[model samples]
Target: MSLETIIYIIFAGIIALLLALFQYFKKGKNRSKLDLFFSFLRFVTLFSVLLLIINPSFDQIELSIEKPSLVIAVDNSSSIKHLKQDDKTLGFVKSLKNNTELQEKFNVNIFTFGNQLREGDSIDFTDKQTNVHDAFKALSQIYKNTNAPTVLLTDGNQTFGNDYQFVTNSYKQPVYPIILGDTVSYTDLKIQQLNVNRYAYLKNEFPIETILVYNGSERVASTFVVYQGNQKVYSKPLNFSKQDNSKIIHFTLPANKVGVSAYRAEIKPIENEKNTINNIQNFAVEVINEKTNVAIVSDFPHPDLGALKKSIENNEQRSVSIVGVKEFVSKVNDFQLIILYQPNSKFKPVLENLKTLKKNYFTVIGTKTDLHFINNSNLGYRVDITNQKEDYQGVLNTNYSPFYIDDMGFESFPPLLSNYGGVQISQPIDVVLNKSVQNVTTNDPLLFTFEAEGRRQGVLLGENIWQWRAHSYLENQSFHEFDNFIGKFVQYLASNKKRSRLNIDFQSFYNGNSHVIIKAEVFDKNYVFDTREVLHITVKNKGSKTEKTFPLILKNNHYEVDLSGLEPAEYEFSLSTKNDKITKTGSFKILEYHVEQQFLNANAEKLQQLARNSSGTSYFINNANGIIKELLEDKRYVSVQKSSKNTIPLIDWKYLLGIIALSLSMEWFLRKYNGLI
Candidate 1:
């Protein structure tokens, strides 16, 4: 087939030719007529032996017709164990065992699937989760053999990934699906949505919103209670409007302490049902009291100052301070945000340091600033008052507003800015206004906002925001709206103006190793943890998978991890824990040298799918007595057929042995005849 092999054959033929010629000449000289004939025969035999030495072989293989494999997929989910469904699956298993005709024709393998695949024996359907993807995966592995057809028996309830059809289609085997059990109408109630603030003040009320849904059921009045441990902090009556609808229940519960708080809302069933866990879902929200201290710096204390302070006081969590600009600049970084009230004309000297607290500063410009200071503030944008009315009534103008002390804190709201021609107005189109402000038109930049360095900055060009409180108090409205606005503005300006990032201290996994690796990510408030890295890790505990310490790794805006060799078990890992202070904690499962075999094969459903895909049958031991029968009854399982001639090459013993015997005998006879023994 190759040039080198051809050349080697030709060279061997040349050598044989030379040897034959020499033998012919030498034998001719010494032989008589009768001996010449025998010698010629011997020469022919030698030529034949030389040709056979090359060693060529040809084989004929006989094959039987391939039949579709019977894939016996069994559902091992808890639902399969339902009184009626369990009996059905059991009966089917028995039927398969008795059906000898079907057994003899198809190759059968048993498999069971639920959350994962269980080979050999079917998993008991005591587990509560149904996973159909596992069955498909199990059958796919068997279908790779390219000889067995797959048959599946399932109710077809999927509870896992979405690639079932894609994986099954890989093998061109026909899937014989056996529908099991009758489909029952399922009506359920569940906690559809929940909202909680992670950081709530200690001993203060925290607002929570919970949405409850009732599917396939009519409207019903229900009671929902919030429980903190054994204490029932709050409860309320909830009434659903109709079937396929939901009700939103709002609660304001007091936090007694500053730490992690576990809360659960229990919904009493209006209609008794088989399943109740779905009716009551438990959710945990951490109640943190890590509030930032804020200091407000204004040129002079005004009438609205008391109203602004009163709102934050009601919160009982935040501390607010009012000070002059001179004192604030001396100790600026001590507080979160600094509110400037008509700051001194020469505030430019501290602009660089002011930028350091970009999200931390809120400037409220008054009518006192001269034209020189207003035009040359060096604050990125200019703030100028084009109109100033002596007297004004604070009438409601815009219902929507997007302007806030901290732009990064909350989502944008509807336009709330309006023109108050009576107030000192900065005529421009890039501003937001509250509804209480005077009405005007166009995209006016009455306020310019930005966050530079670490502070949230805003410039309110209007002088008379305090008029809102004065006007509201005159109307006997209790100044609630004014207080709300000021409190929210202060909170936004003072709050942290950065994204959440994971800062891992160090991590470790133990496998008889005394020392552990410590790794961490270097980040600022603006950076996130997401990447892979190798660093020093620390170890804790006696080295068990159940309680191991692997500090979180930070790379590319995510926490990184590599638990390849961890033992098989659930591990509770944390990052940056000192004196029981855990920065973060998550659960991870490591099985079988971290190869994921335990997880990959944990669901019986996947195993059944793999078998079905390979044109083979999956089975379960609980009803596998018919496996032998199925194999025997398969049409392809007939007696082995043989060919007339050898299907495979065999040794040419007659020719080989004869050559050896004759060569040795001739040598002996020649020696005897020549008397040279």
Candidate 2:
């Protein structure tokens, strides 16, 4: 406390005593010393209350010494267990745990990891997958603030994640990686990767590129075969010397059938080749014979017509035909979707045809658009145009959830040409993009959609979408973002789907190594999305007759469950909720694919490279004990001192309050007993 505060407290005490004397002291009667002492006690009690009203507090300092953390991370994947090095690894862990030198200096944290990270020596090396990036990420989070020195023990082969070398830079601690595999050489011929599109139109040809890598081959000759199911479609001879072992072979396959096409690429294993599992790779593509035709009807020529046409044709399964109003009036019935740009009196016949056909379509209302006719039409929206033109940018609405987008480049995209208009949206609709005028976000809808009379309808009250596409390409060096948005917009408008209260989204098939996720949306009686209901799913393997039930957890706008850990087989599932009695059933297939088994040998060189990148050295399992000696002698590793501050309030002392009450009671009882009154 300062001197000024002390002086104030003393002044309060004196004033309290003076007030007590005036209130209780007798002027004409002789008072005993005991009576005077009783008056003094009352004064003190009042003075204490006055002083404490100032609310005094104090700060207490606490000091602590934290030893450096030494993390020992072990690999717990099938590759390590296959090498039969579990005994050696366990012995090394035991030695580190019992080391006295490390115990005196550092706090040791041991962990095991494969597809995931866990604490302690509870690793049986049974984890089927290895994700080295996840292990590094987990360690970085756990020991980021400490003076951490990481010791990694693994063969460093990652099967289900990005390359570990790319993810190594995120962890800042010194990485002392131990190479845990033999340096033996074996002949290997493998299909490194296969690149092909996931969808192809029937009666069209698609290209496939295969990368083949081989070692220990001296003028090897092999036959590469491509099989479509059980039928062999392409066979070619591959002859190369050992020096030119890596080759990329390209093949054009025909899509003749309208179904799921599963193809296998295989190379016959040579003699003494160790990893035969990697010699073949299987992939499937969906082939569709039915193609949706889109018709673009415009009264006059516009740049947006060409841009929109090209965007829709990005997908080979869809084709766009641009025509004038007269041509579209004759052929509008042929296209599933019709796009009208600036529909005016000249296109009145086309609009009437659209209403008669009752098909899905969209209208782009610009300055030249006939606002009077659109307002009177049954397009599910009403717009009041003021004949004022403005330039507005497209801003993405994050809450829109009809489909998924990789990214929305709204910040850097250019503005679109729009008119000053008043718009209102109706039922069964949502805004996809909002408009921003002069960089200020507004509630005006740039793009909105609604389903009416079993037809999907969309409205874009703007123009010059070609400028947006050009801006995207200039900023991102690609037109993917703009093209994707426009393409999905047309695709959604063309879809003929009935509204359902319970809807589920999942793939028909998935590879065993891929993560299997199923998403569902539930709506209430009002037909609005509601996520408060409970949904349960029962999945049964077709072959084993075993079933399991899992409850869906509420995610951001829907319910979801991860079934990635399930076995590879065809399974049937049924979903039910407590709020609704209706049950939905579906089936999916898990392909028999094990990517980890293809990595027959361990990868030791990558571990050494990672250690060098992190300013540390690599060591073998036999020399892992040197870590303790190296850390103990290093000057950079030392105990860190930490200080903490705390505050305490004075009002919590209940004993002091009790003492004041006791003094007042004793004074009253003594005065009454002695008849001092």
Give the per-residue Cα lDDT of candidate 1 at 480: 60
Off by over 4 Å in 1: 1-64, 82-84, 126-128, 134-150, 163-181, 186-188, 192-211, 215-219, 241-244, 248-260, 286-677
**Candidate 2 lDDT, tens digit per residue, 551-640?**
898876678999987997778999988887758999887766667667665687888888878887788876777877888898878998
**Using alpha carbons, what is the TM-score of model 2?**
0.79
Q: Which candidate wins on lDDT?
A: 2
On residues 406-439, what C-alpha lDDT tens digit does candidate 1 reach at each position?
Answer: 1221112222222234223333222344223234
lDDT of 2 at 313: 87
lDDT of 2 at 316: 65
| TM-scores for every candidate against the unseen true structure | 0.43, 0.79
